[model samples]
Target: MTDPATLSAAEAARRIRDGRLSATALTEALLDRIATREPGIRAFVHLDPALALRQAEAVDRAAKAGRVGPLAGLAFGVKDVLDTADQPSQYGSPIWAGHRPRTDAACVALARRAGAVILGKTVTTEFATRHPGPTANPHNPGHTPGGSSSGSAAGAAAGFFHAGFGTQTAGSIIRPAAYCGAVGFKPSFGTLHRAGMKVMSESLDTIGIITRSVGDAAFAMAGLTGGDYGDPEARPGRAPRLGLCWGPTAEQAAPETREAIERVAAAAARAGAEIVPIEMPEPVAAGLAAHALVMNGESADALAWELDHAPALLSPGLRERMEWGRDQPRAAKEAGRAAFATARAAVASVMADVDAILTPSAPGEAPEGLGWTGDPAFNSLWTLLHLPCVTVPVGTGARGLPLGAQIVTAFGRDGEALAWAEWVRQAAVA
Candidate 1:
């Protein structure tokens, strides 16, 4: 029999549905893998083996009763920032140690309804911000796993789960996945339900997923999307007509990242995609600062209680950011909102001629050391514009760490982003 942990979510679901694989057996395989690798990787913050077994057994029984949902036998890792009724959700902060919610986050509920076995809570950076987690890159423990959603990406890359839930406030999802060589999909803002998710920045926070392949990502997302929390404007359609952009930020990215982007574009063009080079508009470029301003401002207000009561427990980096946010003039926040609106409009106008935009996922591979997660300069602009973005691993960098390129679409065009991302992945490997 194939090692169940090695199978993709789509494959596991199909096998379970066909009765070729038992949920308990699959769950045990993954659990065993986790036990073996987790000590070195530290991908999870909370793991309940007995509970996972019980869920798998229940799924097996449900299958026998002909009551299985689409994801009947798949396993998933939930980011700690996401509330989980069955496990502790500490949000990677000492202040919230042992915190558990009364209910699952909306995305978690949807996965459970789809019959997925909840494996564990993956480690997250402090409050899903710059503060690093213990999760080391699965490819090389000496290097960092991109922060915020560090464990979700590391766990997926390590084959601990078929897929995992992650959230991106800035580059949380994309950066980590790029670092860990996993496929990260941050849907159009509000495409996935955010209810019960710890709010970092309401304007920038986006729920996403991490998987080994684009197909697995699509499979997981199909079941998790569509709830009262998602925007109605995010609709599915078409293969992408891509407009490639290597903006001013490109200069800051490593040559390897630039090479990855160029490779993906060439591959897409070879695959018959209409790829064109374009420049970033000035207003949209200004939105980068707007993104930081809005995120910091909102986060400070959101964590006012913690800032006031337990500031000592917060990481120095986070504390500084919160303090800065609190001191910012209200006019700065307003200017950020206006800047984002202008940038969003600029993006929309440009999209009239293309289905999606392509860019580098991060500056480069995951950096050495856990003290700092790589920069989010490449990702924040899109987050500010409220566009959908997917980072597909293209190849390895000079250090042999994974490299990725991003596919982005105007706000609410998540389907287009995913379609093009899958296309690019397919073309690259073809």
Candidate 2:
């Protein structure tokens, strides 16, 4: 049976506005489903039935008054890595098990303003890195769900909420969405306010969202996007030229991903959009490596105290990464940042001609087994330079798993990126 909890945010809002649904009933319905699915999925680190209902009741009351706003009565599951004043947001590590904040992150605040119920904090890999969380894929329990947004993707896939929020330091958002066969969006770097999200590597971390479809993703983003949260220089504007790059990514893509792109590209061609083939500078291939250096090295600095105080609290592999982060040379960090800047300039030249670039969101379908999460090599470049990006689900892979093609516009061109992604999404649908 298709669960009411599985409906998208837009659908939920429309139902509520028409008085066909009450926010309280929707919240309870989602909680019931979460209670059933969470035992195996372990998608949430925290759940507050009372608070969720309380918020829902407020929405219901508002609707009774005919005051329903754009997102009135919607619900969302958030990654534990993002701060939430109301819940115990443990960072998937035992060290901070009872941690709670006094305020919601900027993104959370935005959602609340739009009348979204804060369902609860979802699971995240320790500090949003490679350390595995308990989250498993919703499709097959034996397969690994990707991270560090494991819980957010899992929750959305399992119908726990209309949409969910996750952070992408290193494919945390896109990889998990692909693994869960859901649509995920990582807005261009710095577009979404990160005032309350937990800090990983300041250089690469991005706040992102996961939904059932690209249209849902755009709906969720419309509320949170604009200027740099409150910064004047962070303002959004017209989208730049769109450039298309596939070969650099295609060279190493899995067979399934290649086929999905071929199918999507052909479909897009039929829709009358220019599908150009272009090569990224040789340095982009190196961007992944550089991203690793910045992520590991900077992460070492952010969690140095944790590593020193509670090494046993983290997963074994993560502990080793900390040791590695501690020992990695200073030169790697310098070189990585320098290379990132250089690559940004090189990419800018291409951006001058095109409004955006369409690339594969992941290498292929989510792999089976639960040991390790999927790869983020394909997602590293844009994350590094903080470029605004959107993932358009083009089609399914060999196993019926979802596949995505990413649309990347220049940094801060989030509005344009979303529009182009919408255009591509509708074109494919047609």
**Among all candidates shown, the one with the greatest TM-score:** 1
Please provide, for model 2 over 124-160, each residue's C-alpha lDDT reduced to its tens digit, 9 standing for 90 to 100: 8878887777788898778777888998998888878
In model 2, the Cα lDDT at residue 319 comes to: 78
State the C-alpha lDDT per candidate.
Answer: 0.87, 0.78
Off by over 4 Å in 1: 226-240
Candidate 1: how many backbone clashes? Answer: 0
Q: What is the lDDT of residue 214 in candidate 2?
A: 65
Give the lowest summed-lDDT range of ten residues in model 2. 227-236
TM-score to true structure, per model: 0.95, 0.89
Model 1 scores a TM of 0.95
